[model samples]
Target chain A: MTNQSSWFETAVADLVDPQDQRVWSIIVSLFGDMAQEPGAQISGGALTQIIEPMGIKPEAIRVALHRLRKDGWIESDRIGRVSRHVLSEFGRTQSAAVTPRIYARDSAPVEHWHLLIAEDGTGTQVLEDVMLSDDYIPIGRNIAMRAGAAPLQAEGLLALDISPQTAPKWIQDRLCPPELRASCRALLTAVQNAAKTHPEEWTPTPLQSATLRTLLVHRWRRVVLRQPDLPAAFYPPDWVGPACRNSIIRMLDLLPRPSAAILSGSG
Target chain B: MTNQSSWFETAVADLVDPQDQRVWSIIVSLFGDMAQEPGAQISGGALTQIIEPMGIKPEAIRVALHRLRKDGWIESDRIGRVSRHVLSEFGRTQSAAVTPRIYARDSAPVEHWHLLIAEDGTGTQVLEDVMLSDDYIPIGRNIAMRAGAAPLQAEGLLALDISPQTAPKWIQDRLCPPELRASCRALLTAVQNAAKTHPEEWTPTPLQSATLRTLLVHRWRRVVLRQPDLPAAFYPPDWVGPACRNSIIRMLDLLPRPSAAILSGSG
Candidate 1:
């Protein structure tokens, strides 16, 4: 029990945000990773127990829940003095949209890509509108690219099927900026250190498992969702995106998700 | 003999430039069409006979020849008081460079093409330097295209193997501008009218054939050399490039090239 407790504390410390932590965003990531299914709910006590290890106060969690509820991202019900929270339909839809990208394993590299070029001045708006989707990556003010063959019709734009042979440093840096690279490298180290501290003889309690999983998914969600999935040619030489993903997957496998009934039980 | 003389007079009148005639350019065209081969020379008398029918004066021809000599495009030699002119090595090289595009019949459409894109501001010069070659067509300030696979190396530029599927009006207009389209349309009309005047009963003298071939090649060279040979999609709907090429080819077939020896002989 002492070994498990020490390991859990060390893992939580390694994963917590050293910068300003947005409690509302952490809650969204927690629910998205844990209780995303229909009719699944987390009691207010369980939410606090899972999040308090990350150094968030109970009042902060309450305020964030209020904000999330007002913003239509969460809903709550009170039954016999016990409050329970569930993801709203709007929240589930938004989470579902990004869930695949956030949790996706190393997928096959996208084989085909096409470019959309707008006219220099006035046509930029047309391409800008199309770039609102996550699929499009802006190469320049008037140029955007997407994976797959060119559409049969791209109005007011010049569409070309492109096989990107090489890219310059500016392009690689633009796709994976300095801040993103730093975050990915930091997370990789954190996950690697946490994995090494796990003692094989000790298994975590349901609440402990839930707490570790929340921290792992919360930090990783921020990193993985900020960058697009591009071919290896587009990444800088020192980019650790693949290594970061491997460490993250390995850590998540070690900390299996705990069921909601056991997590909410009053021990 | 009377019928042939009348037909030659009408042909010269139909082919003379209504706009300002660049005499030096016309001389270049004349040599490129009739005496581009090594050791081939046109006597002074033959030059006068072939060019005078186009309404240029002998004094104007002499001045143009002097300018061409100063420009290193022509060399003059006097053998037993008979002056002769031949293309210099520099002039022949320049003429041979564009000869294929000037005289090409309907060729197979280029199936492969690539685009070179420069970074927005500073990289434009790199693409501009590449655009100096006739093979590249500048699509925009930062974009140039060529009809072949991408080079193995393009320093400081993004190289993409592109299959251009659809282009907007601005791209088409940039490739084949209004003036080029108008010139092609006008040449098409002229060639169609000239082809109708062929009389089966009459055969032209060598001087007549050389004069007609020079005028045809001169006008067509001014039109064809100014535009790159792009795929049909790059041209506007009103572009007469294919029709103009066909008409010019039919006219050239009707007027066979005269040998330099026969052309220089005094009738």
Candidate 2:
């Protein structure tokens, strides 16, 4: 490979998440970023060209595609001599649900927050139910929080409308675990490093841009989706979520979304 | 006894707490109200004159005095034919602690309140310690609240400085139990009834005034001390604490505290 190709490959490796490289999840991120539009399809060769450089084997990609098809996330079609893949309706819906949060330049500010406390023995199970269905963030064993006003009907729990003023160390650690903080910090450094050194005059073809976008999105999705969208006070003091978010958005803007025809027809 | 004596005696019986008349506790209230000043004393004859109108027998008073002395709450002096009683230093300190809460005509509005939540098992002990030492009021098994800003140091608890916007039924009921609400209502009605029927022109000697004051203070202490002083949101819809407090203070104003000189010298 040329020096230019090797430089791009090194950047992709540095940008990808060091902890998690689940082939199926990477594929979901790829499809979510590239072909999430209705009826959009990427040729099989283009998918391979985008993901193969991330040190993923074609056999692994095949296995992931098989799983995605079996799970109704992707559908495949053969036209002439080339095979094409597209996200199924279920996959598209799933991607649409989180795409806004993952890709938005700014996270929506959660205005009102409330706490629900369960009783010691029997009421914990009820609180578990609310946490599952509602967007409740579990801060402790018996306490759950959600963004919005207190629920009108809290049958067995003490629901309090609260605006947090101070969060002690234990609460901060519980909400933002050490591992999550590390992940965010690592991603922020990696993206900031990539942004700092990239050549200003470099304009790559659609396939190159697609490959970079996939790695960036894949790494960010793993980190961003693990934690809930909570108030800033919920994060640990050393947390780098805001910086990571800014870097991710800025990098994605640098590498604009490539069209399916350009991605498939070139290689 | 004359008809006038019988009338006053019946009125005293009507005003006293029907649920409880623990003699030792009543004596404590009497000492706290009339003789809490350093070096103040109630002579034996005057004590009997003040409390016997509540229909307690002389032997019961002796037994209560025995218990109080044994418990280090009262010290007695025998000179010639009369015994005198004064609160011990420890008893004075204890009485001084809650006297302000009970006797204040106006309840201070709790402007800022916060909730401290402990972890399910281990942190609960720490929270219990804070509750015992601080002014924390337990609202649940692992939760405690107090007035003012959140503490600067909450090691293992989720300390949320909050201004309560709405309190549900369970919280109100938990903080103000049904029995307490009932007690306050009963006191409010009893005090109002006594005030309504009191003759405008009747005048009493120091012994009669002390008897009425002791009984009123005794009954009010039972009801007021059993419940925590909390914000209005914590009270039940029908709670009559404010009204009860008003009536008790008004009636106490009507029946002034008799001087120790008059109490000991008259009888």
Positional deviation of B5 in candidate 2, in angstroms? Answer: 3.1
- Write out the backbone clash pairs for model 2: none
What is candidate 1's CA lDDT for residue A54? 90
Docking class of 1: medium
Model 1 DockQ reads: 0.69
Task: Compute the lDDT of residue A6 as modeled in candidate 1.
Answer: 92
Question: Which pairs clash in the backbone of model 1?
Answer: none
Where does candidate 2 stray beyond 4 Å? Answer: A106-112, A264-267, B1-4, B108-111
TM-score, model 1, chain B versus true chain B: 0.93
- lDDT for each residue of candidate 1 in A120-187, tens digit (9 for 90 to 100): 88888889888885478887778888888888778878888876767777677778888888888998
Clashes of 2: 0
Residues B100-173 of candidate 2 have per-residue lDDT tens digits of 98799987546478899887677789899988888788876788888877776787677777666556677777
Compose the digit string of candidate 2's lDDT tens values, residues A128-208.
998888888877677888887887668768777776655766777777788888888898889888777677777766888
